[model samples]
Target: MTESKADQPDEKARPRRRQARGERRIQQLLDAAASVFCRAGYTSASTNAIAREAGVSPGTLYQFFPNKEAIAVELGERLNRRMLETHGVVFTLENAALPLRELIDAVLDPMIEFNCANPAFLTLLQSSDAPGHFLEEHAALHDSIQDRIGELIGVRNPDLSPERRTHTANMAFALFKAGLGLILGHEGAEREAYVAELKTALYGYLAPVLGTEGVPAQP
Candidate 1:
């Protein structure tokens, strides 16, 4: 006798449920890896520990990531993409002439928001992945970010020499990364004050590019 829909095996639904289970397993692994890396750093974190943390076997973890470094690299790539997109939104030419305080605040606010929202990203930033490897791993996304920053600079300063523009971009990127590190590494009022100071320092440099007033407290 033919079975009713309720009694019949839902072949399509079974595959969908399996796919979801697979995704959940991978996410659990990533989440556990993030926690492990944050506490142990990538170099010392172990696949076995991560698997244990994820409530999975080392073999199961391997199905998702070949090694610890692979997980760290993937996390870094994801974090970098998130920062680029969010920070891009935060700092814009629309505030092209804002004073140093506002400009710095604008630049840092998004970073603070993103880091606070995703502590794993901050942890990923501490990984010892080789230089340019994350960018290489997420090439198209990173390139799009580079292009956006390039455009922002051009809009902010039509006369900045190409060499200077490149230098400025590199400096800004470095400062943003360092700022997040500083903020995440510290605690209490001290971290908040440091972030403010770092923002001012960055804005002091950016003032020239924006053609806005220089930093109020600087000579």
Candidate 2:
């Protein structure tokens, strides 16, 4: 009778409850880590500081992540995954077919919004002391994004050779990164102004590169 009782639904539920709590704890730590990384940069951020930010003890944080690098690696992976999601929305066929100005608006706004909100993404990406594996992963993420941009360009301007398409995508991404640095350097109205500036710049560049292919009319 005792052995049978051990296999009851209540017993199974206990592990699940514990797992839910563990998951929540992990997320809390990650959120705190983001704040710390953004404020102090990856090289300067400490596990103790992250623990304090999360309202937990240092030991508690250790229970989830072995070290600061582990926390950074996990955070970088999640941020990179979130970035990949942009392809589904902004890089779609419909958006690709929009006018150059509209395409710039549709793509850059949300991308900028994400980077502004999650400044730690840039922190991890630019950190000189970031873990080696994380940097490799970020490199992969960059290539994937470039590939997506190339595909989007091909959709609008199919006449361009593959080399030209790749070259255009690289230039567009480089321009966005440069503009992003300026955009992220400021806050509030200044940042918004930079966003507008970036869109205008992109329009000027893409207008001629994309030509008159499938691009729709702009107002």
The number of the candidate with the highest TM-score is 2
On a 0 to 100 scale, what is the lDDT of residue 147 in model 1? 63
lDDT of 1 by residue, 134-154 (tens): 646545654565666665666
Measured on C-alpha atoms, candidate 2 has an lDDT of 0.88
Best-fitting candidate, measured by lDDT? 2
Model 2: residues with Cα > 4 Å off, grouped in runs: 1-9, 212-219
In order of listing, the candidates' clash counts read: 0, 0
In terms of TM-score, how similar is model 1 to the real structure? 0.75
Q: Write the per-residue lDDT of candidate 2 for residues 158-183, one digit (tens) a residue.
A: 89999999999999999999999999
- Model 1 spans with C-alpha error above 4 angstroms: 6-9, 91-103, 116-135, 138-147, 213-219
Residue pair clashes in candidate 2:
none
Native-referenced Cα lDDT, model 1: 0.72
